[model samples]
Target: MFIRLPRKLFLFYVSVFYLIGIPVHAENNTAPTGSFKSKACMECHKKNNPLLIKDWRSSAHANTQPITDCVACHGKLHQAAASSSRRDSTCIRCHGGKKDPVVHSYTTSKHGVLMQLEKRSYDWNQPLADANYRAPGCSYCHMHKAGHNVSAGIRDDLMDKAAEKKVREQTRIACLDCHAPRYITRLFENGERMLEIGRKKVREARSLIEQSSVTFSDDELAPARAQLVKMQQHLTNVYLGVAHQSPDYQWWHGHPALDGDLLRIKGFIGELYRIKK
Candidate 1:
């Protein structure tokens, strides 16, 4: 049987601290270390936490299936996590296996690539020790049974509703997980849109660079180049932005193209007019 690697499911909380009016408490509210499969179980989840009741009573995941309880997907709710792992063998009991396309696609992507590499090379990893040999599994996002004091993490905070909506629209995965193909497609579309806008902005600035490049020798070129450099930097930062602190992206993603364009244009102007080849 094949399994897919875990994907990032992000939710945009318009409210940074929806729990600002609330408190952050750490209680051993992990229910009896058993399954959440009964009305009693569901009630218990909501009962202990007034806020859980309020938040989930209106959640689609609450009563996702009337016949099947939350345990059907989330696993034994109150169990002591049974080891911090991303095992999905149990999940495969319901949503994975050789026939699942998500399983297939994941096995093909980088996430899956890691698993295969690890499995083949890690003779010590001859078999998955727990259902969680996979890191970052389904439960990490959806059906998450974490927290105390009746909470819904970021959902509690409030932010710009429109921005939140845009985030969701742009991200069909809805923060939990998107079906396999859809996830890839959504990413491509997002990148395409960004690249499009970025290229357009680059073009707009290129004309200015061209004009400045021609009429200026090194003296005039210095200041004009500085201005162009600033504009280029601004566009690069805006379009290729990420939250991570990584140079892999800065040189490869953010700067290469911009720098290349500038050098090429500068060379062209100088040579075409013999300003300073």
Candidate 2:
């Protein structure tokens, strides 16, 4: 006769088998992505350095992008030797690049130059409150309230109606503290108009480039490609320069260069098409 196992024992064994199998499936499914450990940093800082934590919590860095943790700016070894002298470099890591027009514009702006000059004489360890800083840095305009939201007034979302309204409102509030309401409004309007013009020019240049690709040979396309790239760079520079409060860059380095590149591209397209005909 076959011995009957108790129902409880049978169910217990089945449950253990399923439990063991589930983890193998789950491990494959739940592999880690590169997510920041911001909560861990916050938890530790909140207890050990309450004031610093408070400032960071209220700033745009903590509020906006979750990935932008203490390690993002301060680095992994910040606890041992955190210094404000490295702030510009740390910020530039993300902001000041060839592709990043906004922060890159700041490096060529008057404020950026002044900040660089002041840093030569200023002490990194000195408290910001006590330090006689000459010009505004990235933190001065964007992080006025020790805010972490760098995108508060300087977002490139003016094309969207809802985003435009929100950005304009935020920009107004931010500008009013340092500038008159009329001046701020005028400046924003002018910048917006210039950006629209720049966009049209870039689109025209790109269209010409596309046309050239079909009409011209690989060797002939090199110059067109170079001009197109230069035009795009200038367009981006001008758009960001206006927002960053650098009229000289907007006019001299940005719009003028863009216009020249656009003209060159147009000439190239015309010559290529004429030769094809």
Candidate 3:
């Protein structure tokens, strides 16, 4: 008999070194709409990296990255009339173009999918998350904040040009930000969900063995099929965009269970399928 593992237990076997899961359940998905303070972030960042401004000059966020910085999305809304949810429709407005280079690739990403269908697909009502720091999106990752320590230093070691201390630190911080508590929590959660998918896939493949020893009937198999399909839905919803259509993720992370062999993935992506690709 093949080995069987439960979702929670199986996930432990496949998580990245730093990932860990946290359970969260919410029914309401109201958006946040508060104008948080941004003058502070702007004050120092403007002086630190002049070029940073250029990146946003013609970009969507620049036009409306929320002058309130992180708070704009995480906090609350209080203006001319009253409070309101931060509608994601605003984000989709300029980023909806499929052929537009800057946002085209991102829109097709899982994050894009989540953002687009957040209200309808899952519980999007802003929840406390029992999280100390509110989750930040495109803005927090790119913008600077008050008391924002800047260790940006010269990377002459790599880039011939001297690195702007502020810019470098912000970049480093961005990576570290992913490795933080929230990052680990998210990965572990994804892993746990994947483990269930992995189990369902195994069951599906076994059913195809067509051996005397094989046991499940069509009616009995219906549930597994449904589960696996749900997992694939998640595959498209969650993991498809991280590395783009890279061979490794499509294979190791996405394909194996979808098709019995990883080669199917490699063939689909072909060469030049690495992340850097």
Predicted candidate 3, C-alpha RMSD: 22.7
Instruction: Give a tens-digit lDDT track for model 2, residues 1-277.
Output: 1345667778989899999979986686453344346676667667756877776665566676655677777555544234552456667777657436666577667878788777677554433331234565666555544444565665553333345556677556545655688888888888778877887888888877777677678788888888877876687677678878777668877888878998988887788778878
Q: Is 1 or 2 the stronger prediction by lDDT?
A: 2
Clash pairs for candidate 3: 28-125, 29-124, 29-125, 30-125, 33-76, 33-77, 34-76, 34-77, 152-165
lDDT per residue for candidate 1 within 224-276, as digits (tens), equals: 45645654654444232321112333335455655555566566555645744
What is the TM-score of each predicted model, taking all chains together? Answer: 0.33, 0.61, 0.26
RMSD of each: 19.2, 15.4, 22.7
Candidate 3 Cα deviation (angstroms), residue 273: 34
**Which candidate number would show the highest TM-score if scored against the true structure?**
2
Candidate 1 C-alpha error for residue 256, in Å: 30
lDDT for predicted candidate 1 compared with the true structure: 0.44
lDDT of 3 by residue, 135-225 (tens): 3323223332311121131121221223333443444444354358566546444543553464455444444433312443555445444
